[model samples]
Target: MKDMVELSRRELIKIITILNLGTTLEWYDFIIASTAAAIVWPQVFFPSSNPASALLLSFTVFALGFVARPVGSILFGHFGDKLGRKTSLIWTLLTMALGSLGVGLTPSYIQIGILAPILLTIFRLLQGLGIGGEWGGAATMATEFVSNKRYRGFWVSWIQQGLQFGVILANIVFYALLGLMPRLEFFEFGWRIAFYVAFVIAVIAAIIRYKIAETPLFTKLSSEGQVLRVPFIEMMRRDWKRVLIMTGIFLQASAGFYIAISFSEAYIAKFLGFSDSFAVQTVILGAIATIFGTMLASFLSDLIGSRRKIMIISPVGVILFSIPFFLLLNSKDPVLVTLAVIGYYFIELFGWSVMPTFYAEWMPTQYRYTATAFAINLATPLSGGLAPIIMASILQTFRGNYLIAWPYLALVSIAYGIISAISVALARSDTAAKKIE
Candidate 1:
């Protein structure tokens, strides 16, 4: 393995770009599923006597992907930690593309009856598996390859941006299609086109990902016979507390994000009585804020010499802003609602931006891929996966009164804030002790 000194600045930039592109495609598919579940799928795949029941069913299937993610983390995490990042990433991309294409091409429930939704569930599970492993591999590859420790946060921030960019692209595509076609037409055929586009994006991402070299850290570990035979088990035995702490920290961010992106759109359009176009526009604006906020937070984390500060502050921001966000949505005015969406996302994305670097820096290289994947993916089902379902259930229970949902989200954010502060403090103490040794 060549030292970091051997890798050029240009090479590092290329690696970051390639890995970011792969995740961009991965999240593009995700946003498509999320968008569909919120709007299109209820009408098409899960048609029922009750409208609320249909939406809940769609969200349930959406959460099923989260249920499968931990399995993906363990399965691909093994190969990722034991084999190579590049190889694992290429396969994850392929699986994601295939799953998306399958969803795009499947017949509607009206045409195929029960078979249609069954197939959709299967494909979504495949996507869950693909993305489960993709994040850790891409994050590890980008962070470990960088020679300068100071700029590591900045580079990993680009990977986070991929998710925001994917949301942007997905919203833009939906916005354009909705603008071009009538509502009936969009529901009939236009939605499928988004998935087809995801497949193409995945192919491009896979090609770029395939061209990148393995990280120097992984190479060094493998060469020195330091790679764990079972990275997930080793992580469990040695770093379970770290894993639990990371998962707890991640849960708040994941739940807050889904509530902002996934649940808000449905709440605005259906419960708040806004148009579908207005809802899509709100999400697009929020995605833009998220991109800007992520970059700003990443840059500031480096400048301030602590990702912990950003992590701790983010959930508190979410908790404080939760009421205003719902109040703006309740206004039913497009402008205020837009402000609400963007304002919450700007703060929420700060935690998202710092997570890649935090996870990468904390875990040892031998089990970094498995540990990071397990921590994040395990949290996904608990927090991100259930957030929309929980919100939807709350709405259902209250007979569509959104006022109750706000407090639930606020409490979750507050818990995340407290846990994150404690975790960050402990991590810093551990780092200081290691340095003293």
Candidate 2:
């Protein structure tokens, strides 16, 4: 138990990497749907007289996944707290895997009629449930495994980076598949295979997750008879502010991400009329930058001792760059298009790369799962789910111009960034770690 409190660097990296990988896999499954929807979902699952309405129908079903997230948090959070991080994670990954696979295998609207969309919505709900528990468990695993008080800023951020990795993997696979096949073929058959691939990722992620020992932090807590009887109630009574603050912080990150990925997918593939592979390649290049950007943000946070700074400044920088990036996107040359995608990727990672460190630090060891899950799950899916749809609607109804939508994303990023900065400062100044309680 004493040793559990002070983990070694080797053990810390091992646990952190596993935590990162699991979430990476989960996010890959999660993110692929958004990309698929932007390109394929409308044509396959939803039928409408107009392209705008069809896209809306697709995004509406996408949003359905978000609405069910809180329910997943409640159900899985209960099991994660009462059971253990290890056991709960295995279940969570498998759930997401199955759901993702179902989506990939689903018969299109042409064949299934209403059943296609109905089945699609059901699978997305399953994904929301799996992800609901994934972040809290992953965050707790990384933070709790650390030895030195200071290392939390560095390694905990790795968990967040895992998300970037998942996104990277998803983008690479999607575009690579698109590239290998013709656009006509991709829209026809290739998209379904992407969903099928999740089954493989899930099996591997589950095996890796199962091989790891239960986190020492949670095991010690449980062995000492300190496990909460009701983790959600404990979170509400003890540290609701952390939930609220982290939620705000997550809003910036999630919105930035969805704009870069979700909305951006539609922007590039649907709007720009780029080849499906080219669109995926654009996203993949950005993912390449994120791998570096996210780790760099985390590493810098360790040196600076302030994650709030990274969260606030990087997003604003992204907002400033939005115009230039959009202009490059318009150039339409593959080289310039790739650069624009990469640039946006860097902007989006700014918020995501740093938030895990800050968010994971917000809770005490006892209630980390509940607090982190509630903040992040709600923040992400709501923002991630809505941003693309709203952007689509605006483009359809008001702005005939696509790049004009940058202001909308930029404004949301700034608002969330301001709120996050204020909250972190308040938390840092408080002397009692238990102030939230």
Candidate 3:
């Protein structure tokens, strides 16, 4: 083993900025689409005789994006591992940008008949494909850039911060639009502005990404002729168990986040009698809490020198608090709802904050991007993608019974948490801090 090249403070900041921007840009587009699905898309693209049916249809489209993620993950992860993270990242950002642009330019169902929903679905899938590749490369870049292995958690947490920031931006933009325009006007045209803004963010992130250099580890591997011809196949053959374990570990974060941020919006608006703006506001607050909480959790992981411990602890806390979170939401008191939102977001970060570095540490440099992306993306479709649809189906099945619906969602989260905790506990992987090869 040789010493990893140390980046200067300036260079490290530049790298973090580039990765953070790309992550934020990708997620902004993704989350904006999700927010619209909850509030705006039902009327614009998937209008129906029954409002519930329309909402469900819209959520189906929303879930389709997640379904496309694993495909994106495989496609991008292969290139990320075989080529260079920098190049793969730049392309992913552009793909997401184009998807957002398409969504923005797409006409409403009133104008285009069935073609409107179909175009929306296509654009959303493109966004998913772009995001699938974006996260793993960003995480790999962030983790591999930092010189001190011990602080990788704190450093890579910034990339996760971009996830929260993206949520915040999405909610804030939607909230502002809700306030600025009447409900009809907002639904008609204001929503497109958010997607348009997403395109600009992607373009800016891409330009910034082009200026940054590739991770030193990947560069070293490439220089030494260690790049695999087929990184995904190689990883599956050797690290299949670890991959499965990681998928389980990621389940809670995937399901928990979408449920918290997206499904909860629909629940609050439709069943609880809150305004869409109110739901977006709560999510904005939750995202902010996640940003702060994840930062703290990442720092603690580095301080305690154990990423797995936080991962285990975080899910247990989320499980215990799951009922309380919904209870608070059901209370219908704005203060309690906000508190519940923030609290759930805060507790979950104990696992998510450390996830990037934790996943990166488990894989060798030659294929880290593919393995991490594949694991996370696999969980996305199974958990994140299904989360909103499942919750919506539950509520619909019960004819919009709040009491049954809330508890049921909480129980589902508990199940996901248990699976995540048990998987991490049982898995055999290198969780210790180590220099990247």
Candidate 4:
């Protein structure tokens, strides 16, 4: 308890690198399913619906994971705080492994009837629960373990970029499998293989995570018995506004971003008539954009102390670019689609890359994981879980008219982003923030 040890740059990088790799693998599982749903689930689970409606149903089941995320945050954050950071993260990865293998092995609706979608939903919920807790634990570890100590935002931002890294990996592997398989074979078996592959990735993530010790900050807190009795309750009672700000940021960032990334492949393939390979490739490019844009935005946030500033700009870009984005996709030309996805990549960067820092910065040392987990998770059910279903519903009713759907999406993004900007402008810390008034 009396030790005053200093962490070296090498040691800090070592910890951050492992955490980032594990976080990327976690996202790899999530994106694999989203991409799989866009490819296979509509036929497997909801064969009775029209293609559009079936896709909608598929994403709805997919959203089940997002729905389960906050519950995971509450439960895991409690134990992570009360027990230890390392322990919570290790188990979260294992939970994801079970869910992934479950999805990979589940019988289709044709075989199991209604039980198929039900079991699929349960697996996705478990997946979401694991991810829900994983984000804050990983971010706190990255931010608090660093040696430079000045650019917590940048380092945390780098960890944030791991989501895109996972997306890129998922996209590449899925795209390659699709390329190798015939269309019929691909739809029948390729998708399931991707889900199964997560078992291996999860094992790798666990191995890396196990080698890394607990965050020094958490170690310090443990010795002092500083863990919260009830982190979510304390944050809700004490720093409710940050929760609101995070909710708003996620509402803006997640819904629109999901529409752009998660929904884009099927949207383009079905509505715009692109080939499967092109659609998958478009997602890959956008992921690449996200990988780079995330780090760039995080670097800027570190310099500016304006995490909200980055999020606020993304929606504005969406509103201004929505028409062009739609137009770019509609042409079905690869170059134009790439251009559209590139625009989306930057949009995701602007909104998402800053979120880790923004949410983490909103709370102080005492309740960082708790506040960050709760605040950031509001996006799951509202924004993350619902975006694909909402977008599918919008297109189903409007029949894929951007005139109707994009404006509505843009409006939602605008309201959320503006409010987020206001909150960021007002919030200097939990105690001094004017937006709480």
Of 1 and 4, the candidate ahead on lDDT is 1
* Clash pairs (backbone) in predicted model 1: none
CA shift of 40, model 1, Å: 0.5
Best by lDDT: 3
Give one clash count per candidate, in the order shown.
0, 0, 0, 0
lDDT of 4 by residue, 1-437 (tens): 32213766677777788888878888899988888788778887889547778888999999888878888888877777778777888888988988999998888887889998999999999898888888887876665565235666677776777787888888888889878988787766677887788888897788778887776667787778887787777878888876776676667677666666678888777777777678888878887877777777877766775666666677667667766777677677879988998786677457677677656655655677776776667676787677678778877787656556665645554554565456455554432111210
- TM-score (all chains, Cα) for each model: 0.95, 0.90, 0.97, 0.92
Q: Flag the better candidate by lDDT, 1 or 3.
A: 3
Question: Which portions of model 2 miss their true places by more than 4 Å?
Answer: 5-8, 147-149, 331-336, 403-437
Which scores greater on TM-score, model 2 or model 4? 4
Candidate 3 on 1-437: residue-level lDDT in tens? 23345556677777797789888877888899888888888889887776667778999998898878899988999999999999999999999999999999999999989999999899989999999999988998888888465677888899988998899888899999999999888888889999999999789889988998777788889989999999999999999999999899999988888888888888788788988989889889888877778887888888887888878876798889999999998999999988988888778766888889899888888789999999999998888888788878878887778787778878888888898988889765546566666
Least lDDT summed over 10 consecutive residues: which range in candidate 3? 1-10
Badly placed stretches (over 4 Å) of model 3 are 1-6, 147-149
Error of 4 at 349 (Å): 2.2
| Number of the top-ranking candidate, with TM-score as the measure | 3
Residue-wise C-alpha lDDT for candidate 1, range 303-401, written one tens digit per residue: 877777777777677767777777787887888999998888788778779888888778888888888888899999988888788777767776666
Task: Please list the residue runs of candidate 1 whose C-alpha ends up more than 4 Å from where it truly belongs after superposition.
Answer: 403-437
Local distance difference test, each candidate = 0.82, 0.74, 0.86, 0.74
Clashing residue pairs in candidate 2 (N, C-alpha, C atoms within 3 angstroms): none
